[model samples]
Target: MRVDRKIKASYEHAIDNLDKKEENEQLSEDEFLERANLRSDLQDLLKMEEINWKQKSRVKELQEGQSNTKYFHRVANMRNWHNSLSCLAIDGQVVRDGNVIREHISKFYAELYKENVLLRPKLNGLLQYDSLDHSQRDLIEWDFDEEEVIKALRALDGDKSPGPDGFPMLVYKCFWHIFKVDAMAVI
Candidate 1:
C-alpha cells in the first residue's frame, strides 16, 4: 500500500527538525539525549501507525472480497455437495428422480408442520405468568433512545457472526457515534 501523504509529510518534517537540532552547537548533553530519545519515540510511533494502517487495509480487502474469493466458492460448493439430496429411500426402494425428491420433501414438511390436535397436549392452566404493570408496559412500548441503542450494541458479542449488512457487532460498537443517527432512524 502507498504511504499516506499526511503521515509521510509529518515524518519528513520531524526528521528535518531533528537534523536541524542536531546541527546546533549550543545544545548540552542532557538536551541532546532528550532530543535523541524524542526522535526515537517519534520514529517508533510512526512505524506502529504504518503497521496499524496496513493491518486495517488488509482486513478491509478480505471483507470486500469475501463473497468473490475462490476459497468462499470452494467451501460453498463443498457444503452444497454434502447437503445435496441425490437419493431417498422409501418402502425399501431407492428413488433418484429430482422432482420426486423435491415433492417428497415438500410433502414431508407439510405433514410435519400441519396442526394435529392428537399430536399436541393441552396446556391450559399448566403454567401461569404475572401480568406487566402500567410502568412495565410503558417501558416495553417506549421508543429506543440513543443511550439504549448504544447499550444494546455494546452488549452484543463483537466477534460473533455478521448481521444482514455483512458487518459484525464490533463495527457498530466501534463506530456508534458516527452511525447513531442513521441507525436510530432505521430502528
Candidate 2:
C-alpha cells in the first residue's frame, strides 16, 4: 500500500512538473491553450491506462474462472449464453473485435467443453476447429449469427469451410439423427 501511494505521488509530481514547464515558457495565448490541452490529453491517457490495467486484472480472473470450468452448465441453463453469442445476428452492433470475442468466447468454449461429454477427450485438446488459418479465422470463437457471417463470408468469396461444429446447414444432422428421421426430407 505504501508503494502504491508512492507511485501515485510520483505520477502526480510528474504531471505537475510538466504543467509547470509549460507555464514557465512565455508563449502566445494560443500556445498556452495548446499546452493546456496537451495536459488534459495526458490526464485522459492516464485514466485510460488505469482502466486498461484494471481490465487486465479482470481478464486474468475470468481466465481462472474458465480454467475451473465455471462457464459450463447444463443445456437448459447454458442456453442463455448461447443465445447471447448468437444474438450477434444481422441486426446487432457487436463487431469483430478481438477483446470482445476473447471475453465472450472464453466462456463459450468453457461451456462447450462442459456440454460435450462424448467428445471430452477432444475437448481436452481444445484445438480442433480453432486452426483454420489466420486469414480465414477470427482467432475468437464467437457465435456471430452464422447466418449473417455466412452472408458476409460469401460476399468476401470465402470458401465453404466447416464451422466450429461442422459445415454450414449440417448442424441439423444431429436433430435428424436424434429424432430418428429419414434423410429423404433433407434431400
lDDT of 1 at 52: 65
Candidate 2 residue-wise lDDT, 49-145, digit = tens: 5565445545765777644333333322443543564333223566566566666768778887677656556446666654577655664554445
TM-score, every prediction:
0.37, 0.23
lDDT of 2: 0.53
Give per-residue CA lDDT, model 1, range 23-93, as digits (tens).
77556787667667767766676666556655655565588765566545554465466469899986688
